[model samples]
Target chain A: MNLFKLAWKNITHNPLSLLLNMVLLTLGIGLISFILSVNTQLKDKFEKNLADIDLVIGAKGSPLQLILSSMYHIDAPTGNISIDEAKPFLREGHPLIKRSVPLSMGDSYKGYRIVGTDHSILELYDAKASEGRLWSNLLEVTIGSVVASNLDLGLGAKFQSSHGFNDDEDLEHEHGTFVVVGILEPTGSVIDQLILCNTESVWEVHDHHEEAESAEEEDHSHDDHEEHDHEHEHDHAGHEHSEYEHDNHDHRNDMSRSQLLEHGEKEITSILVQYTSKTNFQALSMPRNINENTDLQAASPAYEINRLYDMMGTGTRALQLIAVLIAIVSAISIFVSLLNSLKQRKYELSLMRVLGGKARTLLSLILLEGIIMSLLGFVLGILASQLSMAAMAGSLADRYNYEFSSWQWHGSEWYLLAASVGIGFQAAVLPALMAYNTDIHENLSDA
Target chain B: MLKTSEIRHSYKGTQRFTFPEIKCDESSSLMILGKSGVGKTTLLHILGGMFKPLSGDVSINGTSIYTLRGNNLDTFRGQNIGIVFQKPHFVQSLTAEENLMLAQKMAGNSVSTNTVHELLQQLNLDHKAKALSYKMSQGEQQRLSIARAIINKPGLILADEPTSALDDENCKKVVELLEDQSEQLKAALVIVTHDNRLKQYFKNHIELS
Candidate 1:
């Protein structure tokens, strides 16, 4: 009997057309909502991972690639920088630098990179071991929370790393095994997917791989050099060669393992640097000087990530524009449908007028129809976006180790709802006016 | 009670119509008869307060209905005038019973579902009350329209060509229903039509030229 009930009934009267209109609007709003949530999550995770670190000094290569690889762990390392060449920045008492954590990465277990880094890097992520303790010896490792669960490597679990970032069993470094000494708390950053160990672990595995390759060469009759004589003793017996023989061979070798571990021309993948104070001019000048004069590349995570965003912004903006265009088209569709319904209901409206219903009463009934359609579309659109986000959550987490939840509200959603309702109002206004100005006498007498 | 005097109307490019004065009292029925071009519908509209006459006055229940303007005029019309058009019309989406309730609501009258149900039963349309307004048979729709017209207990009931589309039996039944409902509400009834079949049914009637 009420206008609202009447309006609802009218909408349902032509169920197919109203449903089509609602679906059009739902798609428009759903697309924008989906993009808003995903984009916000990406920016949030990027910003969180970029926290506090002033500079990344890595091997000379593309500065963006270096930042992406060394800091964000999403790309390959530029190259290795010799420790001798990076000594000035690594020194504890360096005036401009507050701390530096050295990282050497060339190995991975099941696609999760094992990062050979100083224990200080754990502090950078505010990470603490959830079980056992941090790595204290070469090849002893602490796994990130996500890594531990994904690989199911608990405390005291042992696994050997492969030669590079791929999961190739052929390149396994069977000569050395990394034991899980600790599992870190979830930091929700790149740290959550890393295996933390000391820089010496990287050198130990690669060095042993080198000697094993050399022994294979000797086995193929490539050389009979004096050094090849010691290769037979520990050829591939799971690194169980005699300790006395290892010591004797170490003395006879060009450079012993212990000597190489203690500063004999070793290389590290990158160094994460922090300044004494953010406002200090050295923070800016030091990176500039290093990029200009040295064999290393020093990049700021903030600058590189912002540049990435600019490159990404064009695609996002275009999509948002398309979403807006869809909404406008939906508004036009709503306008046409309402006008048509008004035309079809002209006789009924004239009857109402004859029965002493005011012009405004008929107008309100039509207007209520428009508002109901838009509000229904809005609710359906929001639910669709959330369901889609829930579906994507698993894949995003699996691939990037980043979690995305659709339940989180985006700031733009309220504005989107308002715009949708406004479009509904705009669409209905002309039709409502038509109903309001209905020539009751003419229509009734004509009928 | 309802009365009209000096009512005249003209549409653009159409002949002007000056209607004859008429008066009818409570609990009575009157029919205004005319052929196609005599402006019987126009006079009905003026009497119902849906259209303002070129120069005329219409009063129902001793209050000048046309003196009210805009919303107040609409309120007065809604409260005092009940109209049934030649073609039965209802908000298509509403059921038969809801159409009556809507009439009461639009007239700013308190709606009682019990009254609506009882009216439908009395009109022999209780079986059709829950049916979609457009889905009912022609006779059922006509009765429902009559039910809606009397739902607000208006002082005057106007019917425009109500029996024009009916057969002899339906036409006679419709005239009796209109008179019976108006009598129950004590409202003066006026039927405007071009049909001669209704002449034998109403004693107090006028023919428009």
Candidate 2:
């Protein structure tokens, strides 16, 4: 007997129009919600992995590509730079530099990059071993949390490295087999998808291939050399044999830090630099100085990422505008349906007035119907968006090696709820006023 | 008792009407007869408290209804007077019984299922309690309309051409039902119609040319 029950009955009395309005509303709201969720997650991932690196110095190439390759590990490296040319920035305790971590890439295990770096990388990303211990030897390795779970690699698991960032059996490096010694905890950063080891391992694997190729050349031209050349070849083969035997006995016997640094001819892919004071004049001038005076290219990660966001913002803005337009269209649909029903219910409204019902009662009854329809559409729209996001999460993670969660609440959704209710109220106002002003004598007359 | 005095009305200051004074005592019936365009429906609207006369007063049970104004007038009219339209109309979404409950509720009275069931049984509509009001036969809809009007046990009942659309047999049956229900509540009854067939049923009559 209450207005709410009566409104509900009136809505249910005409099923086709109600269903039409609900479908349009659900589509419009769902699209808006889905876009908001994806935009939030993309911004979150990009900001989290920025990691406060002041500059990236690499071989001359695109500055954005340098940041993407060295920082996010999503693109190909520009090229390798000789360590001798990069030594001035890599030196310890330089006045202008706070810290620098050198990176040597060009290796992978099952599409997960094997990054060769120093212990400073672990501190840079605030990474800690969740199981076992961090790698302290040349051939040992530490795996990211995602790599461990996805490839099911645990402590003491052994795997050989491939020459590039793709899984190809032909490019497998048979001379090197890395043993996982630790698994890092998830940091929700780029580090969670990498396999980290010291710089010497990458050098050792490639150096062994070079020496083996030269030895085969010497065998084909044995007659051209003198007796001393034969002895020199035997001595080098014996030295390599002893090193191989020592690898199995004790991993700590591998090349020490000083010995690896003494080899000045080595090459590394990039160096990630942090400034002693970011606001200092020298730090601000450092990237430009390196780019102009030297052969190396220096790029600021924050600037590059901002450029990337600006490029992406246009597409998202267009999509958001389209979603809002659809929502407006849905409001118009609700208005038209309610207006039509009001026409059909003219006699019924007059009957209510004659039966001692106030004009305001009829007004509230129409308002209640509109609000109920909008609220139902709002709830269903949100559910549909979240469900679709969760369904797409698996493939997104596999493609980008980043996790996306749909359960997190966003503040914009509350605003969306308010907007939906406002639309409902706006649509109902005209029809409700019409019902309030119904002509009782004209409608109820026997003419 | 129901009474009116100096009842006069006009539409947009053009056509005008001056109705004769009317008075009906408890348990009595009065019929106002006129052809179309003679303001029979206008007089019914004024008597039912839906239209305010240009200059007139309608009093039911010693309370002047038109002078009450706004919601007070609406509440008074709902509690003291019942109206039956010429063409039977209802809130189409509600069932026959729910329509009765709604009338009682709108009149500031608690819904009494007992009274609703009793009225439905008396009007031979007990089997249609759950049926949608608009889906019923024309005769059944007419009976349901009467049930809604008197659900609050008003002191005055007004009918506007209540039987003009019915066959001779159904018209006779409807007139008997209205008289029987009005006598049971001991309310003053007024019927306005162009159908001369009802002239023989009421001794008290007024005609407008």
lDDT of each: 0.83, 0.86
Error of 2 at B131 (Å): 3.2
Over the stretch A80-162, how does candidate 2's per-residue lDDT look in tens digits? 88777888888887798988889999888888989988778877899999998887676789999999999999999999998
Fnat of the models, one by one? 0.78, 0.67
Docking class of 1: medium
* Candidate 1 regions with alpha-carbon error over 4 angstroms: A148-154, A157-177, A205-261, A279-282
* Interface CA RMSD, all predictions: 1.1, 1.2
Positional deviation of A288 in candidate 2, in angstroms? 2.0
Which ten-residue region of model 2 chain A has the weakest summed lDDT? A253-262
TM-scores of all predicted structures: 0.89, 0.88
How does chain B of model 1 score on TM-score? 0.96
Please tell me which predicted candidate would have the highest DockQ against the true structure. 1
Write the residue-wise lDDT of candidate 1 on A1-447 in tens digits: 788988999999998889889888999888888889888988988888885888999998888899888887878999988877888888777888887888899888888898877767977889998999988666788899989888899999999899887778998987788899899999888899899886667767876876877767878888666656545432432243233235434443222223333462567899998888888886679888998899888998888999999988999999989988988888898899999988888998887876678989988988888988888988888998899999999877665556677788878889978988998899899999999999878887778
